[model samples]
Target: MKKLAKACLLITAVLFAAPKVHAQISIGVTISANVAPPALPVYVQPACPTDGYLWVPGYWAYDNDSEDYYWVPGVWVAPPTPGYLWTPAYWGYAGGVYGFHAGYWGRHVGFYGGINYGYGYGGVGFGGGAWSGNTFRYNTAVVNVNTTVVHNTYVDKTVIVNNNVTVNNHNSFNGPGGVTAQPRPEEMAAMKEQHVPATSQQQSHERTASQDKSQFASVNHGKPNNAAMNKVGGSHFTPNGQKAPRNNNNNANNNAANNGHQNNDAAKQPNVQQDGHANNNAMKTTDAEKQDQQPAQQQQHVQQQQHNQQQQHVQQQQHNQQQQHSQQQHKQPQQQHKSAPKPHTEQKHEK
Candidate 1:
């Protein structure tokens, strides 16, 4: 009965808390109810698949029509800009309405309802890691980092308190009996600095999670089977509405094995062993394969004819050279005989 009264007071608080443009603004709000949102479910965080990607923890998103809270799985996303860190959105109780503050990418971390989103997001500020220019340094003490892939890493235990928000409670909102964390000085300053919205990858991941029936609080009762993913849009639903891995290496392996077996069987055939040459007509090709090779065969034949013509031209030139040499030799001998005879006959006549 006391819990019921407290829930009613919490709802009343949401109804009365004054609006702040400083708080997230929206046109038409619906998810707020007299009841508190479901408790945060416990799930293992998937290891960081690769670096330069920050982890966005999973959260419950409300659907007004069904009044159901859908679990958006945690995913690693590449930031829009270098040295920017992601501050996750959270549901806080305000104005008697549980409004959601959308997350953003900024130079520094902002207030996220002091919700203890583990892995460096320790309810106050992000202790997971920090960035140096385009290079992001991960806090090994907190984040589930893969060191082999991401080398620019550091281990730090130092923590700074930027938000004076009340702690030691699991309340999912800011109204009565919920989190009373007001944005501290640094968080407020961080908000004023340049801010970037969530990346397309993260938006797509949330959309996919929203469509999965198994991710709803009403369906899972607080725990989702798939709590995290290595990358955004990793989970796929087929056209038949069944969740299945897009690329199944096992199926591909089976197909390759089947093809190998078929090849072995074909090799044992007599016609194949003879390569269709038994009747001098073996190695018959398909009509399409033959058609594909016709142009190549024609090119090869043309090249061979060109080579033969070149050889013939060289042989003809050699033959002409030999005939010219023989004619020259015959003319030289005739000239020599004529010169010797003339000299001997003139001497005899004189005597």
Candidate 2:
């Protein structure tokens, strides 16, 4: 009986230690840090190298091992789908410590702690551009796009913004001296809507940034040398860097010379490892009992957050249904009036 109890407890611990994953939007515990993250660095937006690419703004990301902040260089990336917009993460102070909010790819731009991550993300709805069908249009006023390559664009200087949130103050978080902005009603809707996780390329870019010492604020003091890149990986693609062309000819000499050479250091970045530090200590029954006693507060807080999420999702569903109905009403006549070869119907009834 004693052996069986011990085995069951070990199994329970293993299951609890594994991270929980959800199919749609990932809602997890907010990570907390004692120190406030460094201020946002000033960087020029790199031109959209190709069409269908969206710019992800630069921000400070915390490393668990170093316990210091590092700058993840902004890069233009293609979203998981055409309509999805990138919601940049932000730090918010609460419970006497700052918590990191993980961003997600949602149908609409969600509240990002009201941090104005410029270049179209001015602390509210995305001004970068809108998607027409499968093609993404660029806003030339804020977003830098090559007009020759990207023609589906317009000059919209007056981008929509929130009046409540301060613009361009350069505070990197939400609370205290930071931008104290709450999630608006529309933003709350986006939070509960279906979301897509960050792409593998984006994850790789973050991992690469974590490895770079120059990107750390302590080293460069908020102005990173490699501030932005055209692409995520597959090149040393700084906005101003020497370009080295590779010879891919099938000749025996060329093939032999390039066989051992590796390209794009960013492409070879390792996966972001878990920050768990395992201690091989035997469990005590009294300690387990003490953990159970503390569950009341933890469970209450989690339950409250879950309730808020459920309410938001319910409200979003209703809003979506209404919008969809309105759209159908508008399109019904246009669809009917469209010039098309009508299906033939027999006139036997009149006869």
Which candidate's lDDT is highest? 2
| Model 1 per-residue lDDT tens digits across residues 218-326 | 6678766666776786653322223545433323222223232123223335466533464334434456679889999999999999999999999999999999999
Which candidate ranks first by TM-score, i.e. highest?
A: 2
Off by over 4 Å in 2: 1-30, 160-167, 234-351
Pairs that collide, model 1? 14-95, 14-96, 15-95, 15-96, 93-174, 276-282, 277-282
Task: Tell how far residue 295 is off in model 1, in angstroms.
Answer: 47
Q: Judge candidate 2 at residue 216 and give its lDDT.
A: 62
Angstrom error of the Cα, residue 229, model 1: value is 1.4
Q: How does candidate 1 fare on TM-score? A: 0.58
Instruction: Give the per-residue lDDT of model 2 (tens digit) for 212-329.
Output: 6655666667766676777786433333433423222213222222222212232223331221121112235557777887888789999999999999999999999999999999
The C-alpha stretches of model 1 lying farther than 4 A from their native spots are 1-34, 160-170, 235-351
Looking at model 1, which ten-residue stretch has the lowest summed lDDT? Answer: 253-262
